[model samples]
Structure formats: structure tokens, C-alpha cells
Target: MSKTILITGASRGFGKLWADAFLQRGDKVIATARNLKDLQDLSDKYGQALLPLQLDVNDRAAVFAAVQKAQQHTGRIDVLINNAGYGLFGAVEETTEQEARAQMETNFFGLLWASQAVLPIMRAQGGGHIIQVSSILGLVTLPVLGLYNASKFAVEGLSETLATEVKQFGIHVTMIEPNGFTTDWAGASAASTTPMEEYAGLRKAFSDSATPDSFGNPAATTPAILKLVDSAQPPLRLLLGKVALPFAKSVYEARLAEWDQWQEVAHAAHG
Candidate 1:
């Protein structure tokens, strides 16, 4: 069945690639971005199969309006892809209150508002899928990326809760945990704090670990993403990229080891 997939931040990066892939598969896409002009080319290529709308996920009101418009245009929203987010790089102490709040506003609250906007409609339609673009950072911490990590972690929690809450309504929520991807997400979309001498070593280490082209091509995950959307028994969490799976395993292993080491202390809390 051809689905009507509404994608935020559809102007570029993984979101843009998803839009193209969905269109290729003959699915309807309601592509959205802050600047509608960025989506004009997609509109031309896919014709009516693609609907471009202006949406700033940060604006709660705008999110509702965009969802309404999408439902109106397509008559159904089969999938709602919340992909409008950015990385804010900096150590915990290096970030300012305003910067941290802004990061949360877009990466966490923005996704929350969009999810809220779509739920009622999905209930009315009888079923839908909510795909959230999270990160491996959501499961494991990284130096110089505390703010971004916090945002993704919040997304992971919300998406998990949403899955359980909406399962009865036939709505599915999937959190996509992609490691470094060759997308503008690491380029133009990312914002870095003013470098401080205290965090210089951490910053240098981060850069050294991430070599040029170290990230996997975003398009390589397109097929997997589509399969996830099309699956009736979709997983609550889907990790993309070669490193994402192994890295997540390591994180869980380390976490379990800590639990085992402090099992007595953990039980004491409940006692």
C-alpha cells in the first residue's frame, strides 16, 4: 500500500533522502522545512506525489497546522517522521543556559509537539507510524556533545513511552538510532559552542576520532528505514549504520556490568 509519509526537515540530510526514496516507491510525501523554497525542487520532481509545506518544528502552533494541512491534502498520514533536529557540540560546563535550552527546544520539545499533533489524527485514521530520528548518543555518552546527547536521550524515553501508549490504537513508534552519517547533520546543521581552553582536549579528541568520511552514507540506510516503516511488527528501536549496533551493545554491556557490581546498592533503594 502506498503511504502518505509526513517528514519534517525534509529540505536536506536524511530527511531529504527519505523523501526521495518514499517518492520513488510511489508513496505520498508531505515534505516540510522552515524555508519552503528548499523543497521546491523535490516538488517539481515528484509532482503531486510530493507536497511541500513550510514548518518550523520548534513552533507548536505551526506543527499542528502542518499536520492538519497534511491530513487534508493526503486524507491520511500513514507515517509521521520527526527528523527536524540538530547537534549542539560542547562540554557540559562549556554550554550556556540559553544554548542548552535552545537545543532541547528543537530536538526534544519540537519533536514532542509534532508527535502530539499527529496522535489524534492517527487515532482518527485507525493506524499510523511515528518514526523518530534519534542517535547512538542517546544510549551512550560522548565527550563535547552533552547537550546533543541529552536531547537524544529525552527522545528515546518519549518514543518508548509513546509506543506503549499508542499500541492499542494500532499506532507504532520507532526510534532510529543512527551513528555518524554522511549528512549535513554534521556539517551545516550542527552548531558548536565557543571553544574554551578547558574543553580543548576533549574537542581535539572528538575531531581525531571522527575522520573525514568516517560516517556512513545516509542513503545506505534508506532501504532499512523503508522496511521498518512497512513492517507490521516493527521494532521499538532501530539502530542504523555499521557502528551503531556494536556501539549500542557495548553500552548495554557496560551498563549491565555496573548494575551487577552495584546490585546490592540498587536493591537497597527500593528497600
Candidate 2:
């Protein structure tokens, strides 16, 4: 059966691609972005199949109103993809408190609000799926991306817990951990904190390691997402991209090994 999906951040990047893919698959997509103009072409191309709505996920009222509109369109929202977020790169000490909070508001609380807005409707309709477009940073940290990593880590935790909480209602939660994709993810629009004079050396090191071009193609991960959407038993967590998959695997393995090596002490400490 074709599903009705509401995707946030549908203006560009993975969100735009996902919206298009869903439309191509005959699924109804309520594509949302901060600016409706950003989705004008898609709206023209897909017509009624793509309902472009302006939504700042951080706005609770806007999110609820958008959900109401989407529910009216299809009477049910089968999937809610929270793909609206951006990275803020800087050293921990160099990044301002406001900047860090702004990242969390969009990447973490934004998702929380959207999910909260949809839960009631999903409960009334019986079931739904929540797809969180997290990142490899959710599981592992890297230099210059502490703020982003924190936000994703928060999503990982919330999505995991929400999965169990909503299981009885038939709602499924999936966290997408994509490695660097050839999206405009690292573009100028994706802000970096004002470098602090005191942290110049660290900032330089971070810039040297983090570049916009260091990742896989966005198209490469789309098929995997489509497959999961079509599957009868989709995984709760999906690690996408060649770079992301290996990186996630290594992180999980290393953590496991560390745990095994310290299991006795861990048990003793917990007890």
C-alpha cells in the first residue's frame, strides 16, 4: 500500500531527494520547508502529490498546523521524516553558548516538537512511522563537530526511547545515520562559529580536517532509504553511505570491545 509521508526540511539536500523519491513511488508527500519558494519547482512538478508547506520545525504552533493540514489531505500520516537540521562546526570552547543552543533547538527540540504534534493523530489513526535523519556523529564524535554530534546523540536517544514507547500503538521509529554525503551539507549556509582568538590553533586543525567535499553522493543513500520504507521489517537504526557504514561499524565494535574488556569492573561499579 502506498503511504502518506510528511517530510520536514524538504527545501533541499536529502530531504528534497526523499520527497521526490516518495512522490515517484506513488506515495503522497507533504513536503515542508522554512520557505515555500525553495520548493516551488517540486510543487510544480509533482502537483497534488507534493503538498509544499512552510514549516519551521522549531515552531510548535506551525508544526501542529502543518500536521493538521497533512491529516486533512490524507486523513492519516503514515510516515513523518524529521530531516530538518544543520551542523554548526567549531571547537567546544570556541562555539558560543547561543550558537550551541541554536543547533540543539533545530536538530533536537525541533524533532521533539514535530513528533509530539504527530503522535496524537497517529494514535487516533492506529499507527505511523517516524524517520529521524541523524548522522554518523550520533554514535561517534569527531573534532570540530561537537555541537552537531551532541544534537544527533540527543536524537538517537529520543528516537530509541520513542520507538519502545510507541510500539504498542504500532508506530515505528527509525534513525538514519548517514556519513558525509555530497549534499550542500557543508555549504556556507551551514554555519561555522566565529573562531575564537584563543583557539586559533584548534580551529585551524579542525578546518583542515573538515571540508564540504569529504563525503559520498546523496543519491547513494536514497535507495537504501527507499528499501527500508518498503520493507516489512525496517530496522530501528540505519547507517547509510560507504563511509558512514564502516565508520559506524568501527565505532560500535570498538565500544563493544571496550565494554567486554571492562565488563567485570563495570558490573562491580554498577553493583
Q: Please report, in order, the local distance difference test score of every candidate based on alpha carbons.
A: 0.91, 0.88
**Model 2 lDDT vs. the true structure?**
0.88
Best-fitting candidate, scored by lDDT: 1
TM-scores of the candidates in the order shown = 0.97, 0.92
Taking the tens digit of each residue's C-alpha lDDT, what string does model 2 give over 33-145?
98899999888888988888888888888889999998998888989999999989788887898998899999999999999999999899898888999998999988778
* Collision count of model 2: 0
Candidate achieving the largest TM-score: 1
